[model samples]
Target chain A: MKPLTTGIAGIALLAVLVLAPLGLPPFAMTLLTEAVILGLFAMSLDLMFGYTRLVSFGHAAAYGLGAYACGWLLLNTGMPMLFAVFAGALLTGIVGLGVGWMCTLATGVSFSMLTLAFAQLLYAISFKWTSVTGGSDGLAGIPRTVGPFGFAALSSKAGFYYFALACLVGGFLACRALVRSPFGAVLRGIRENEAKTTALGYNTRLYKIAVVAVAYGLGGLAGGLYAPFAGFANTELLFWLLSGQVLIMVIVGGAGTLVGPILGAAFFMLMEHQLSAWTEAWALYFGLIFIAFVLFAPEGIWGLATGLATGRFRPASERH
Target chain B: MSTLALLLTQTVNALSQSALLFFLGVGLTLIFGLMRIVNFAHGALYMLGAFVGYSIAAWSGSFWLALAGAPLLVGLFGAGFELTILRRLYRRDAHAFLMVTFGLALVVGEAVRLTWGSDALQVAGPPALSGVVFMLDEPFPVYRLFLVAIGVVVAVAIWQFLERARLGLLIRATSQNADMANALGVDVKMIRSCVFGIGCGLAALGGVLAAPLVTASNGMAATVIIDAFVIVIIGGMGSFLGSLIGALLIGFVQVFGNYYAPDFALAFMYLVMLAVLVMRPGGLLGKEA
Candidate 1:
């Protein structure tokens, strides 16, 4: 999408999201909060996957670490929510820097497997450290501290929803600026042809590692929000299934673009909510839809929307 | 138990576990070797085989029949899936294959839950192998011994088939260069479907063997798949010898790690895998990427 059109569409969508809580019931308002938080998570993935073309198979590591750290800080310390969240994100970024550096040594599927291995290690520790993580039952009653001035908004459902919305929009703009900057152009070059980029004396590995850290930092920010919003953090947050779930949202919503994955996340959560309410075997239906999208609508929802606008439908494969 | 008995029992445990891991890893390696597509549904196929084995054994009143029937039926089902869905996907890149197989895993997993229900169901060890044996005054189930023997026999048989048989030669040739083999008159598509079926069959075989020990449940796939990934990474993806060696090493790590460091057994395995991956991305015995 062009900058002007995407800007307009984004504002219009933001307007709708802002007003949605007024019309929604308590349950729906809560669900919307969950969706927005998840959307931010998916957008973080888009930063690496869509732009950098790094298919991280274990992104949940960053998110899960953020959740655990944020939960731990809130429960054990008297830090404000905002500070705790920032600390969590910063910690994940540092970890991402190290893990990403090591993983970037190998390319393609090997890189993916390396990422997965690290996440599995974290999952193992989280499961075993019962005292710290609550093991299987997970950390519970995570206190949500109210803001810079001890405002009560962080404690309420509607208030948390707005806070999450602000984070999403802010994160989105940060991502947009990152992708449009010269650093982002280097990332795109590396994504397209790393060998050529390297030949151009661009230190492609450093760029790749940089993006992974930035991407995971934002992912941590999203997870930090989740711990407070959900009032708990579980081992499942770090599981590979969540990684796959977020990846599906990014790809199916339309990778290579900033806004696509957020929309995809909202669509997925809403559909899951509706389907699971009607049938226990909703995954069966969801899987079928997912398979169909891979087989047919390979460009994903955003691609279909843009294709319709241009009035030129094309069958595109899964290409970076 | 004495120290000798404890050592003996854990060795047996590790060997049996390695046997099951071999069955899962070898097939995955074969598929990866030929198609370069990791079968995410391999674990689901294993779980499905166990569930199907349970139902078959329940109906037939024989554990042996399930061992034979589960793999055969699942293998056929895998072939059908290949012919229908995967045939069209060879044109796309690796990510598409991963996503599609993941979708397949979800579908198969949910389908199993719907068909067999969510509760774990036990499959009795065959009565012929149900008797206990003592080693150093420690009683051991003979069925686990049978699993080890079966693993060795399958490994040897697969080795012979690949190293000696005409079909094995054809498979090797195709894996080396599919287009060249196709140009020379080998049916490439047929070879792919056959390999995929064989891989799924091996996974099912592992599942049937494991059912007696672990019981049939949906979560089995989640646990085993992670093990498979660790093994694949350590053994090197697409390397048969690498998988076997990797599986045994992991089996020991998991068994002994559980004994010595019960808190971080899984972590131990991953740490080993990470060390191997960092040192040699192609795996211990596998070619360097």
Candidate 2:
């Protein structure tokens, strides 16, 4: 009964998010679009880090790769938006698979560092490879094509907002379904205890690689959507700092819970907006808040709420 | 030949660069090895040391006092951070600690920017160390030689301390097996805090020495830390000797790479790290066990 109520509440919140563009001003709609895309990106990261216990610090690589793929396809091949988005995500998945193979060989800090190193390499390539990536100026003038559902137009702010909303909803639903499946159970098992899962004859490494690929692919989809809407894809997306931001969002919102990432993404974006507006030294304040969270609410907002409701702040099964 | 002189100059430059790299890399390696924390704010602390040194020297017109006082001040700040924020994160996973420290780096960078107003500043070398020294008929900065000497002496001192001192043995034991060391009444927590302070102080000392060579900027910390991490990883995470060798190798690689393709030097370093991992997962000087 509690789960059902939570599910209904989630749907209500998502409905509000989807309808927000209808009534909000143009600038507000644009912010909504960014929030939706970042929310999807955050959700993709949590799928692997939260469920699989693989701390990846190179997701920006996949995101950048996807954006470039879509931008490249649109400019060179004049492909449709629908085909371009999926194609971009496919290319990102391939790259993710390759990087994940290398990452799965190591664990703990080495694994995190390897992913960061690989991403850094990609960032360097993107910056140097001017012919393809626009050499830091980024690819501009990305054509906004009609939506796949045959909507009348999507070049307008409201149209694109709706388009972004659809993508976020689709991605969020797909993620929820994926986690509820048998594969997700195995991933959870692997997260809880890799040794026991390996002992049970499950190929833990392969599962990790596969899930990472999926998560990266989804993240790439978000990036691909972002390119047409924002009309540019820069090398900055490949930076490790962007990856760090995603991790912050995941941990800040509460990992493992399906709705947690959405809340986390909204909160992170909103906090940045408010803090930066208030002072030039917001980064310092941001750091202080993050430190406070690490010390006090390490379980994050959703974790804290669930803990309070259940009257168990320290669940043995949910030990980080 | 002029080409010969240039080649010799590059080699001399590489040696000095290696010293600078070693000074920072060794401190990072010690922290990572001893405390199991990545210390992402290390570069920021280094920057602070440089700024502190420059301020003191500029005010008092005494480079010598700045050399000694900068590191002490930065070390106290590092110690305070460890006690106030970092200690609580000791039991958290490395990823959490990494995020926390990364946040700390951001905080420190912004604070530096607020204090310095984002302007780049250069520190002047002391009069005695100013001017050029002849290295096989090629002129090299004399301060560069001083940096190398300092690096060598510090490396030797650290090597001796880790090998001969009682605290060093405890650190080694704690790093290898924290539980066993705790069981043996080694005061593991105190050792970790002290090691962190020392590690941070070493980074500050490097910054003090490096201030005259490199311009102080808020943005340099992140870039320097990335380079330092590459060197540390290549040298083996916790090995002091590994850091020295790795820094020299990386220094040469950077010099040669910049000569060949200036744009790809950083990428070339990553490729080298990948190659090392493939050939030997334990890193160059890392233990196989």
User: What lDDT is obtained when candidate 2 is compared to the true structure?
Assistant: 0.83
Best by lDDT: 1
True contacts kept of each: 0.60, 0.51
Docking class of 2: medium
Count backbone clashes in candidate 2: 0
| Model 1 local distance difference test score | 0.90
Kindly list the per-residue Cα lDDT of model 2 for residues A264-290, writing each as its tens digit: 887888888889999989999998888
TM per candidate, chain B: 0.99, 0.94
**Model 1, range A1-320, lDDT digits (tens) per residue?**
57798779878989999999889999999889999999999999998888988989899998999999999999999688878988999999999899889898878777888999999888999999988999988899998887678767667787788888999999998988988999999999987888999999999989989999998898999999999989999999999899889999998898888788988898899989999999999999888888898898788789888888778766664355
Best candidate (score: DockQ)? 1
RMSD of 1: 1.4
